[model samples]
Target: MKLKILLFAALCFLSATVIAQTKDSLKTELPQISLSPVPVEVFAGNNGVSFQLIVSKYFKPDSRLGFFNVTQFTGKYDTADQAKNELMSLALISFDIWKGFSLNTGAFIDNYGGFSPTAGIQYLFANKDFLIIALPRFDLARNYNFEAFGLAEYRPMFTKNWGFYIRGQAMYNRNIKQDFLERSYVNLRTGVTYQNFQFGLGYNYDVYGGTFNSNQHSFGVFLRAELF
Candidate 1:
């Protein structure tokens, strides 16, 4: 009930914002789209794949609207511990308010079948060789948790056809009402890039729960490609 109300309110707010902009804006440009088609990471006991899509268009020189989505699925290959298998997704609608800063509203669906409606602020920077994003949000459901996510990637060219790639990503979610950490993770990747593909080594450390927490460390290789 409350989640539905919050979702409705967010949709209304975004619609009003877009309608207001279109009233004064010249024209809407065609959206630019980017996709990562099932990037895979292979680990000793767990293997995972992730898919991402982003679409953005400018309504004015200083303002734009975008949609971002990410889906992750992991499987445990060595054990029957279904708890170690996970599926999660995040989807957001973002509206630029200032330079590299945006207001975002979205939903996060966790592996345990929990759905959280989230409202947040995000900062994004991207160029030919660098990309960075930082987001802090509040969960509108389930004790109103606070969540922060960050990602940074650098791909600098060593020659016309080769480049070095490194990326770091992190996420932390805390149940503020209960005064406990719900989930946290850090992921790192480094390797070389050729054309639109990247081959890399990856490491991830994940912790779940509050005082009696369970953690996991995974090291693996990964392959990623950009599909524009």
Candidate 2:
């Protein structure tokens, strides 16, 4: 029941985020989907969707990579606003290089849910007892004209599953044609976890370089569903 509620709330949050946006600013909204949404694009268009193939293989010590190409065919939808029978294609490549230090890179086409290529480096200290991941990330398409760039994640207990984390991020895309279109947010996340998951809330102050439509005291749960 709790899981179901969590899912409902997650969706509600995503929708609320979207509804809060002006018709013009509705592009930057996204649902809190499974960390891993198959690199695929679903669109409402006239063309039918198609698929592409992505391959992944091991490279360096404990490092591996994979890519996915997917296509959608003409289909129906539950929403009236959604396009009918349209084709869309997307590709994603996720790579991780690991040794004492680790690096991850990913890129995608036709951004639907902020799935784009970004680079980050992780450094471990004291026999990998302390760790930190520095990621400057961004999404694409009309959905995310506002690029989100930040450095997030720090594990003080590199070996144990408990520790603290600090994250600072900014969102900005100067191309949007709106008065309060240029915006940025700064927040902090901290907590402990048993594994790769972090349990806590974040507080952020977001603004469009002005005051109107700004957000303060934005809080939400934090989690990471990691595969290897």
Candidate 3:
């Protein structure tokens, strides 16, 4: 009788341990989602409003192969009349093709525009707090234009909940008729963040609207929130 009781207890312990392990593994397989509001100068002058939503899932526990979808809107602030400049949605797959580098290939749709293929590369460092991405593509079928876009960002933490970040992006486009269109735009931003919220100020220069000698400056106030 004593031996039987000991065997029963041991079997129960093993079953419980296996169940816990399975639950943990399932949690790791789930995807992560984040949403934020990223206002821009193009919509409401200095008060333009934009939003972004991202959903990503890793193929394995090590975050090597990942799939993501990003959607964004930019234009004038919310209004009953026309208040939007552009709407963009992208579906991308990112893979750690080599050490310290990753490759991204995706399809993007612009403002009800047809789908356009995109391929880019990311250089990640400093535990992914610092990143540089470049995407240059030609939209020959729909827009008949060649475009190049680049973004650079750096975020360094001072403490657990405090940090600073600097980010910038540039875009250039050219069509058959013109060497470069008036669509060129550049923005530089720096700000302080607490926890998942960021507050900052930035400057935007619109090349299509003015020349460098008479460049137009758009001062912008920005805030971001991380909704998981």
Candidate 4:
């Protein structure tokens, strides 16, 4: 756990440099569609090491709404080698409810995680170089109830060809009748973005049932590309 914290700190250090750099006064637009691949390490839960591959897509129909899809495939080895997969999708609608603050809501569905209605808010600060997002949802499925997640990203462009970026995501889930944390997931990453290409190293963790219940941790490297 200590090592994982250190890795997260390293990513944040790169982001800290952005505070000293000049910020872009103009808002930069994103692509209409983007596809990226994320690979991570899987430790514990299973008896041996494993790898998880996720293919994700981001689509924006307009400035106010966006949609996303993620498919995951996992392979592992233990007493018996096995593989599993899941598909999750989301739709978000953005609103300018307050100054420097944005609100969005829609629905999220997953093959294994269950279907859930979700709402979120985002705050952009530090010359628009830093962003924070909070999202919460309730799964309609009988298996689970409430869940909340948040994401933070910091990107600072040093030049036309060089830039640094740090991103972190975490989620907490619980059952309807019970209080206290039930399930959790965390992802932390930091790397350099060169034009449309990105390379990074990070850690991934998932826990089910309780805080220290059945859980898995992984540290690995990932590469992403933006092809509009």
Model 1 per-residue lDDT tens digits across residues 80-110: 6656677777788887654466677889897
Per-residue CA lDDT of model 4 for 1-228, tens digit only, reads 343335435534543443234234212333322333332323223233333333223333334233332233344554343432324455555443333344445666654456666554434333435655565545433443566767676878899888997888787777654555666678777889787666777777867664335677767666656544
TM-score on alpha carbons, each prediction: 0.76, 0.36, 0.60, 0.59
Candidate 3 structure lDDT: 0.55
User: lDDT (CA) for every model shown?
Assistant: 0.69, 0.36, 0.55, 0.52
Candidate 1 vs candidate 2: which has greater TM-score? 1
Task: Report the number of the highest-lDDT candidate.
Answer: 1
The sequence of per-residue lDDT tens digits that candidate 3 reaches over residues 124-228 is 333436656565544424444455666787878899999997878777755433434635667777898788776788777655421322344567766666554
Worst 10 residues of 1 by lDDT: 29-38
Clashing pairs in 4: none
Question: lDDT rank, highest first?
Answer: 1, 3, 4, 2
Could you say which candidate leads in TM-score?
A: 1
Clash pairs, model 1 backbone: none
Instruction: For residue 123, give model 2's deviation from the true position in Å.
Output: 13
The global Cα lDDT (0 to 1) of model 1 is 0.69
What are the runs in model 2 whose C-alpha is more than 4 Å off?
Answer: 1-148, 158-161, 176-181, 208-213, 220-224
Better structure of 2 and 3 per lDDT: 3
Any runs in candidate 3 off by more than 4 Å, and if so which?
1-47, 53-57, 68-70, 77-84, 120-122, 126-129, 138-140, 176-182, 206-217
Steric collisions counted per model: 0, 10, 4, 0
Segments in model 4 whose C-alpha atoms lie over 4 Å from true places: 1-86, 100-103, 119-128, 140-144, 178-182, 210-213
